[model samples]
Every structure is written in structure tokens, then in C-alpha cells.
Target: MNDVSFLPHARLDDLIQLLLTQGFRVIGPRVRAGVIAYDTIDAATQLPWGWRDAQAPGRYRLEQTAGSRCFAWANGAQAIKPFLFAPREPLWQARRAAGCFEVQELVPPPRPLAFLGVRACDLAALAIHDRHFLGGLHPDPYYAARGEEMLLIAVNCTHPADTCFCAATGDGPQAAAGFDLALTELDDGFVAQAGSQEGRELMQALVLAPATPEQRAAASQAIGLAAAAQTRRLPAPERLRRLYQRLDHSRWEDVGARCLSCGNCTQVCPTCFCHREQDVPALEGEATVHERQWDSCFSAGHAWLHGYQVRPEIRQRYRQWLTHKLAGWQAQFGRSGCVGCGRCISWCPVGIDLTEEVEVLLAEAADGA
Candidate 1:
């Protein structure tokens, strides 16, 4: 089967219908309360057509255009992370019996999901999560169940936000891999490619014609322009690996002065995987439910130990998060945790740009040398 095909804008609903027939709950990007967010969709009309977003440090705004594009925006406040690594979930339930207690694991049943318009940076983050949750010595059954059968339909980025730096992270502007189907949106239609057996079967079912050379070239050129337009960048991995050694760097104190300690960066970050667990007792005292929710190193409670906080100061917490995200993550996962999606920059109330912080921190080290 030919991997590359042209899907006319009009026939997009046909593809959604086919996924529905295959028992997938199709989720796509939609304009919700003036923001492009992922939601369930039954037809192509639900997509944010002719909509674009302008993003900057501590700012995001929606703009309407006279175009027919559905994915002209960069990304939303949240990624597919919440879908797999649920913000809050019950781990187990304990029932009090006549003589003993019975525990029931609360692993959720797998639901087939088809996500449309996944960005390349998000795909890279998803790969890091796969390594964290599934490639560990003890696999996370909860995350595994949710992600095992998920279908990824990637949309190559052509309109990157000013805050976006996926190109510097080597993760974006084009869909390189980790997708079933990849689409490059054009004004008239989309240039689609199948990356998996299931994706090939679906393309065959769509019966789309092979994309013309002109269409393919246009898509490639648009992605290239998008890449070139990004002004933000992160230091190379080699320099980032030394970030932990700068624990007492003055930049930490400088950034900490403006930091809110609100953990918004960790929450918006695509690859931050800290979580906390607690047990909730039932009102009747007959049961207790153990639940886990997302956590952040920015929280004072995260470093709590023996009734004392290890990172009590805001500067220490800020340093901890930055060093761990850029340096410690490499030691543990063989890659930096940041995928350069820039959600941390735009969603932050104070707009603490980690890329800017890293450059300043590393530049000082080079000058001192």
C-alpha cells in the first residue's frame, strides 16, 4: 500500500466516521472558551477550522483568519499526558469485612482512543513517558492500560507559536515518527502518510489518491518555514548535562525572585511525572480508597522529610526543578525531560522561560572557564 495519500478537506469526516466504526472515541483539537483544546468529536466541523493562536511568555490569544486550516495553532495548555497519566485516579479500594479487609486494585479498563492533531514535540514527550512508565522495572499498569491501544494521528506543525522551540529540541516542525498517521495540512487538503499497519489499513479504506508531488513539496516547505521562524532555543544536551553542578548559581536566585512557586510549570510541562498518593476513608468507615494525583517539585511538600523541608526556599525549589528537568532526567532517562513545547512559558503566570535560564546559567560557566 502506498504510504502517502492526499485527503481532501471535504472527506475528513469520512476518516472520522471510519475511526468511529472501528470503535475508537475520536478526540481532536477544538476551540473551547477561546482556546484550542482536545475534545471528543463526531465530525470534522468540530475541529478549530480557520482558527489560530498567538502565544508568548505569559500570554495566549486566539485569532480568526479567513483560511480553511484546522490545525493552524501551536498547542493547548495541556497535551495528551492527562489522557494517559491521569491527573487523579484511584489506585485501590479497601473494604472492611466481618473479620478482615479486602483490597481491590482499581486498574482501569482500556478504552480505545484516537487522538487527532498530535504535535511532534508532544510525540517526543509521549516517547519519554513510555520509557518512564512502561520501560521501567515495574511497569505502571494504570498508564499502560490507557496508552497500550491509543491511536496517534499526528499533524505536522506549520504555524509554530513564538514561544515554541521544538526545532531546537530536535522534536518538531515535522512529524518524524511515533504516529500511526501523519498529516501535513494544506489550504485545500492534507498530505497524509501511514506509519503503521493499522494506519495503512485505514488509509486503504479511505481510498485516498496518492499525494501529488506539488502537494508534498508544499507541505515540506511550510514545515521548513515554521522551523526557521522559531526564535527560542535550548542549550545542547552536553551543556545541559552540567546544569546540576550549578546549584549555587546566581541565576537561581534571580529566577526565584520572580517565581510564584505555584507549580504551574510542572503542571504544564509535558514530561514532569511526579505524583502523590493518599488514602481516603469512606464516610461510613466501611471502605478506604487509595488515590494518586500529580505532584510537582515546586511544592514545598514535595521535599518534605521527617517534619522538615529539604528545599524550603523558593530558590532551592526552582533550582531543583530546573536541574532535575535538564540534568538529572538525563542520568535517569537518557534524555532531557523538556521537549520544548513552550507550554511552560505561555501558561506560566510570571513567564519563567527555562530556555532563557539555561542559556544564562551555561553562558556564565563558559565565561568563567
Candidate 2:
């Protein structure tokens, strides 16, 4: 366990088979409908090998590369969020029976899942989610059931997209913790290290050979290159925390004018946790299923109070989201909500970049001072 091991490309499938033998359903990145997405995979061939993604503000395209590395791509549209924090789920059910109503709390059945190729930025976001969902006095049973038996296999990032800024967030290019196992992909294979007892046990089963000194050096060099290649970055956390002080900044209006208010940013964001709950009645009116679905601050109903809308304008809604994500989140959770994965920028229809907006707003503030 002291020395890192090398998992050859040829024996990569053995890792998947080992996980399956241990009662884990393996999920990994694969090409589906022209995009790299995380899905259930039973073998190594399902991974998006020899592929690279080109990403920018409001743009993403996947292209094939000659290299045979499986984890050469930066990221996809979705993170591991959906696996834990489901987009939609039933909360409870009420049945009308014998002159009384019976209520039953609903929780998903436990299923051991092994997530493969998790990036450092996403690992950071996942920690934030752990705080939100499981770190409260009234812990969420639904989130707990799914999270309890999960295994994370992190892959250090080697290909950062144009919009990536995890380096600025102090989250990535390398995964420091929160993984059972960590892998660094090289041309011939992956340099693997175990971070947990479960990972160490699995490593023994794989029977991998100790990684050579050159392979370890190459892995380090590749991660360094990825960190250097990132061109986008956020302002310092303290600087971003001051966003609330500039409520009347004209930049808000400028960005709001171009904003779509479509909620794509919240949907793609790994840490945004707004949701709304409602009851869906059965056709016969005999039973009702209460369900919770993801929501966004941009929605008109999100800020509604009694009968009046708290934030009627696009500028106000946008300001609320930015302030909470950068400032209020620190007060609530001791850190900013954004992990700087850049999904919000790439998935936005109009290509709104939060980092660019933060720089403009802070620059104007400094000029005024």
C-alpha cells in the first residue's frame, strides 16, 4: 500500500469485473448520443477512450484523438450529483383507507455503487453536498440511503477545458482526498493509488505491479500541465464574498439583459440544491405521492411570498443567485458553493461566464473606491 501500482490498459477490464464480483454496479464515462456522459458500464470498452472535448463559454464539442487513453477528456455535462442527489424522487405517499389517511415515508432501496473517473472539482462539490444533505440536525434519509454504500474512484484531471478554474478554487487538477482509489492515466496504462482500506483490498485483488519511478514522474508532470493549461479563473474568495455589497452595480443589469432565465445553469451546476415538492394524486384519488424535484432561483415561483413575487426582475434574480453562491454560502457552509467546474458557463445558451462577470464587477468596485 505504500507504493503506487500500475494497472495496464489491457487489464483495465479486470478492475470492472472485480467490482462486479464484489456486488458493486460500476458507473463510468462513455459516449452516448454524441456526448460524454456518466452511465452504467460493465466493461472497460464502454469508456470514452481516444476522445477529447473542446469547451468554451456556451460551447462544448467532443472529438476523437489518436491517443488511446480512456480518461483524456476534461468533463461532461453532468457530474456525479445525479447519482446521489436525484433530480426527482418520491418523498412520501398517503393512502385514503378506512375513514383515515395512512402516510408512509419513502426512501430508495440501498444499492452499492462504484463511481469511476471522478474529477477533483466534482469531489469538492460532492463534499459540499455532504454538508448540505447529511450534515444537518434533521439529516436527509433519502440522501443517506444512497450515499452510505458508495465507492468513489477518482481520476486526477489531465485535460482541463477552456472554462475550467478549479485551480483558482483550490480544488483541483489533482484529487487530494475523498476517494477510495485514485488513478493517473498514462499512455500505456494508469498509475493507481489506494486512499481507503476498501481500495487497498481491491488493489490486492487486481494484483497490479508497482509503478516505475518514470511512470510516477510522468503522472505528476501531466497533472501539472493540466493546471497550467487552465486559462479561466475566479477572483479570490474574499473578493467574491463582497458581491452582495454591490447590489446596485450596473453590471448586473448588463448581464441580466442578455440572461435567458432558463435555469440551465442551476440544472448543470453540481452544488446548487434548490428543490420544490408537490403531491401527485393517483387517478382514482385514493392515494397521493409527494415528490421533490429540482428548482432554480431564476424561476418566478422561487421567490414568491404570500401572493407577491420577491424578485420580479431578471436582474434581481441573477443578483440573488450570484450573491448566495459566492457570499451567503460561505456564511452557511464555511465555503463558497461554486467549485469552479465551469459547467454553468459551458451549458449556458447565451454563453454567460461567471468568472468574467465577477472580474468586471470587482474591477468597477475598485475604480469607484
Candidate 3:
């Protein structure tokens, strides 16, 4: 394939303008409440520009970074789930009048998303979700349409977080797949590369010219530097499969104790797409509401069935989740449920790191005579 480079600097402004015209509500990271979050951003200025965030266990603070640094922060408080799957949406409503029932289906609002500043890990998470919701036997019409239509303008991580482990999972510090456009922040301009037809059209619309040899070189160097800056990484990938197949007993109890049963890890995890359904009633029982909300295997309710809850032990629940992401998901979907975004590790109130936990399991498993 010919190395296609579009007009570098002009593409940024053009992308903004094009997205606006395309009826997409553009969103990216912005500074709020002393941290970075994904929010409705009008212009590039809304981005956490020139600011690098400091993240450690139980701490996240954004400090002023070098000149014009966009996407300097890794995944913050929220992943892409809330936007794709709304916190609450009426699944359908049933109305009863005079002992008669009528059913009404609910269709969610369609707002074509232009996810600016998406990281490679989030892109990978989207793919993971795509496997279940889109590629499954019963596809979710709600999620499928949005997934198919959303445009991703990925930001190659110029900086990664302390908890991030995408490198180990072969997801990225640099985007290799599942992006319409990929960007690497540079001193003067962003190195923009288009990966698909939509991106190519946008580039053409933006009137981006062929990149200079030096610009192409700069992009390559930027990707390399980002790949190296990953502060946390795992040594093995193939071994994870075996580790999951046979879990170690030693580390399991300690993790269960540290885990608050808060289920924050699963809530924050990018690829954890489980949800529970509920029926809600309107005033006077004239009408009823049915809804689907996000659920986690970590939760006590997840195992509830036949008037009893299985996996009642916190240890069992945690083990099941980790096992599924590594081994069970592969058996079912032929892919790992985890995107290696590190959201579970970073946002867990107790700082329960999945990478550390995985390593422990594998180490103990190997030692058993």
C-alpha cells in the first residue's frame, strides 16, 4: 500500500469543521474538577492541551506538559460505555388498561458519534464489544447501528498511564487497527494518517496534501517514542491462556479481601459489556417500563438464580471474571474479553491491578510440582 499522508496541519481544522457538518457531536478530553474527562468539546482548545496528567495508585493529577501536547492523559474516569450504552434506556413499555396489555418498543436516539482523541486501547475495547453485540447470534440493534456509524479519530498515546497494560495485550501504544484516522502529536502539527474510506474522504474534503518525507519520518518517530513510554507492561501473552486454564489458589483469597465487592473494576472496564434487565412501572400501574442496565460478574446479583446465588464467595466471583476475560471468552468468541485498557486496575478504589494478579496466578501455577 502507498504510504498515504494527507495535508498535515490543515487536516485538524478540517476535521473539526467536517464533523460539525456531518451532524456529529464532537467530544474529547477536557479539564474539569482537577482531572481530565471525555466531554462535549467545541474546538481543539477544549482538549487537555499542553498538559500531562500525573497518575499513580489512588492519585491522578494533571500537570502542565510540554508545548501543545494533545492526548497527554490516558483513560480517565469514564470509558466509552456510558455513551454507547446509555445508563438507562427503556427497553420497552407495556400498558395495561381494563385488564388489557399493550406493548410499545423503545428506540434510542441516534447521534452519529465522532470520537476524537480515542486511544488505541479504547479502539480495541470497541472491537471486543463488537464481537459480542454485533457478531453474536442475536445482535443488539441499538449498539450495532452506532458501532457501524461512529467515526474514530484515534490519538496514538504520546504518553501512557502507570496502570495501562495495552502493550502486553498487543493492543497498543500505537494504533495498528480499528481506526478511521490516527494521529501522533508533534511540536508544530499533528501527523495524520487515514485508515479507511471515511477518513480518506475527510482528508480530501479537508484538502490535505501529500505529506513531506520529513513529516512521515516524524510520525514514525513519534509512534516509536510512545511505544517506549508505556510505564507498565506485561512480559507474556501466550502464557495468559494457560494461566487461566489452571488458576492458582494462593493469590485468589488475598485479591478477594482487597476487592471491596464494589465492582468498580468491571464498571470501569472497557470491554465488560454485561447488562441486566429490569421492569419499571408507571404511576397507578397504567404503564410499565422495561430497561437494561450495565451489570458485572463481580456483583452479588450476577450469580443469583433459582432463589439462590451461585458464586456466593467473593473469591469465586473475582476468579470467574478474570478467567472469562483470559480463557473463557477465547473459547466462546475466539477473542479476549479484555482490551488491556487498564481501567479496571486504575479506577478500582482498592488499586487491585489485573496485570499483577495475572502474573501472580501464572507464577504460582508454574511453581506447582
- Residue-level lDDT of model 3, residues 264-359, one tens digit each, is 877877788778999988879699999998888988889999899998988888998988878777777776777667777767777777777877
Each model's lDDT comes to 0.92, 0.92, 0.75
Model 1 lDDT tens row, 1-369: 789999999999999999999999898998898788888999999999999899999998999898888988899988889999999999999998997999999999999999999999999999999998999589999999998789999999999999999999899978899999999999999999998998898899999999999999999999999999999988878888878778778888899899999999899888999999999999999999999999999998999999999999999998989888888888898888888899999988998888899988898676444
Candidate 2 global CA lDDT score: 0.92
Q: Model 2, 239-279: lDDT tens per residue? A: 77778778889999999999999999999998999999999
User: After superposition, which runs of candidate 3 have C-alpha atoms over 4 Å from their true positions?
Assistant: 1-3, 6-11, 235-237, 244-248, 367-369
Q: TM per model?
A: 0.98, 0.98, 0.92
With candidate 3 superimposed using the best TM-score fit, by how many Å does residue 240's alpha carbon deviate from the native? 1.9
Consecutive 10-residue window with the lowest summed lDDT within model 1: 360-369
For candidate 2, what is the TM-score? Answer: 0.98
Model 2 pairs in collision: none
lDDT of 3 at 359: 72
Residue-pair clashes per candidate: 0, 0, 3
